[model samples]
Target chain A: MNNTATYHKAIKAATSKLTDIRKFVAKHAREHGFNEKQISDIQLAVDEACTNIIKHAYQFDQTKNFRIELEFDGDQLSITLTDHGSGFDPNRYQRPDLKKQIEKKKRGGMGIFLIKNLMDDVSYSSNNNTNVLRMSKIRS
Target chain B: MKTFKIEHRNSDGFEIIDLYGELDAHTASQLEESLKNLISDQKSNIIVNFRELDYIASAGLGVFMAYIEDVRTIGGDIKLSNMNDKVYNVFDLLGFPTLYDIFDDEKQAIKKFLSDS
Candidate 1:
């Protein structure tokens, strides 16, 4: 079985909605014997995707709206967060090499790196001024 | 998600805590407060299980770091285990691996605490 959720991206607007999404997915998955660890992983991915949209997508403008979609399969969970903001090529953004960056204690760009590492798959794309970040994890 | 429920269990000179729900800007302070109270009460050697935690931010990580020095001063330590990759990645990015004892499971974390203590 599978389930899905869609939220409009607005600063702090959809923040509370995360709980609903987590419960919705967790409840369904639990019936099929998904463990607590697997459930937490899905919730974390959703939270990260939503937070990214809130923090980066509409950096300064609150008037704009974005969309986040989460879909879950029996063994895999996927979340696609879409933002229509100043589109930057993710390809140009370099991941800060930890061993090197830690010496200076610089922050930023950690979000992307964290999201990528947590999820089994992660990809970024910009089309028609919309930045879509897709993240997925397979339940083990 | 559900609000965090803290379960404190005492096992052989160690405190095992299960932290549930999301750990973000709004909820990070709660962790700090709980830890502060525990420290004031002189209950040290804490282990946090992130088995049910959904996410964490730098500010949330700040909560853990905030108490490390204080806990260490009292000859105690704070350890974490069972972090989903997403949460683990956040900790890894913050370089927590170098500063704290992080493990893949609760057993390992508990063992590390006992063996080191």
Candidate 2:
């Protein structure tokens, strides 16, 4: 059966929107028969992605907005987040050294780390107008 | 939108903050403020009770990371307890098990703080 489908939402680049974003993902993932653990993983990965965009790309500019697109099929789910401000550089991200972060009082790098760990595959790309972070998870 | 709340319970020498509802980037600041106040007040033997927290994002974890060292240096600790499997899984994925002390029960965490002091 061809069960492929797509969903999208455009949200303001503010911390307040994070709850709505998670709800949107959970509502659809449950409808698509994703298990609790799978839904949690996707929700967290997407949350981390959007949080990074709001903080880094738009710098908490509520006037700016971003888009989240999810497309899923029989055995996989994929999410793409697009922002219009300064895009993130994936190469600049080092694996967060937890002890050092604590010692140095750092708190920024863990979001990307969590996104990578929660999603099965993740990649990034950006143009003059758009920066995109794409992540995918396989249903187990 | 789901609401996030923090309720403080005073123990003999430390304090336990019970969290309710979802904790994400939006609600993380509230937790950050609570931790900050506790540290400034020198009430640092902190036990965060996650029994009612249905969800947590990396941002929530970041709040903990930002403050854990401060509390430890003040001769106290921010021990966590009663995390749901989902929340615990996130922490475990980030290798938090080795860095922070986690307890299956709130009493255990309290006991740990008391024993250390």
Candidate 3:
């Protein structure tokens, strides 16, 4: 039998809400049997995803909200973040050139890159003005 | 407990900024402000000690990217040191090791600053 445990919350898409999001993910990840490092990785990936949604999609509009769902199916754990806003085309993403970024004093456009690096699998989709970022990792 | 905090100290002419707790989108601006204040004051020889930093997101890393060039242009540098493995991994993953100098200990970063001058 594949017993699945899930946790979900609709959090405000604001920077101040990031701490609460991390805490929420850590608790659920721990209950899902993720080790310390795995939990940390998932937490960071989720944070990056939400940060991007708040900054890029919602444009720091705290009145808007986003939903975060964490689910564990057997040894696979998946975290989904959904935002209802105008979405950007992921195909246009450029690998951040750190040197040029520093020279130009650019501060953003690194969240998606970090999310991809921290999660085992990462994907993005948008439907009907709702954008979703799904990140998954196998419990080892 | 606070999610993030910044403390500043001076050692041998190097300004040491101590990072504490989790650093994310909400907290990154505070660190940015600290950096801005230091640079505006012309105290450019900076060393960020991440020994106590429990967490960091891309927003946190972006603060460094935003300021490194300005700091260096003013004839000074920002060296990072004392990062735990997890925190270090984020920087490593982003290729920060190439453009930035990361030291195992705070003293090493300070030493580099002294040597450059």
Per-prediction DockQ, in order? Answer: 0.15, 0.82, 0.89
Q: Could you arrange the candidates by DockQ from highest to lowest?
A: 3, 2, 1
How high a TM-score does candidate 2 get?
Answer: 0.95
Q: Model 2, range A1-140, lDDT digits (tens) per residue?
A: 33798999999999888888888998888877888898998898888888889998999999999999989888788898999998778768877888888888887787888788888999999998799888898877
Model 3 vs. true fold: TM: 0.96
TM-score, every prediction = 0.56, 0.95, 0.96
Model 1 scores a C-alpha lDDT of 0.68
Per-residue error (Å), model 2, residue A95: 2.4
User: What DockQ results for candidate 3?
Assistant: 0.89
Compose the digit string of candidate 1's lDDT tens values, residues A22-117: 565566556545687776656555665655565566663446566656566656666677787766544555665544443343445555555665
Residues B1-117, candidate 3, lDDT per residue (tens digit)? 345889999998889999999999889999999999999999999999999998889899999999998899999999999999999999998889999999999999978887788
Candidate 2: the clashing residue pairs are none
TM-score (0 to 1) of chain B for each candidate: 0.92, 0.96, 0.97
Q: In candidate 3 chain A, what residue range of length 10 has the lowest lDDT sum? A: A86-95
Error of 3 at B79 (Å): 0.5
TM-score of chain A of each: 0.67, 0.94, 0.93
Best by DockQ: 3
Order the candidates by lDDT, highest first.
3, 2, 1
lDDT of 3 by residue, A11-64 (tens): 998999988898999887787778999988888888888888888899999899
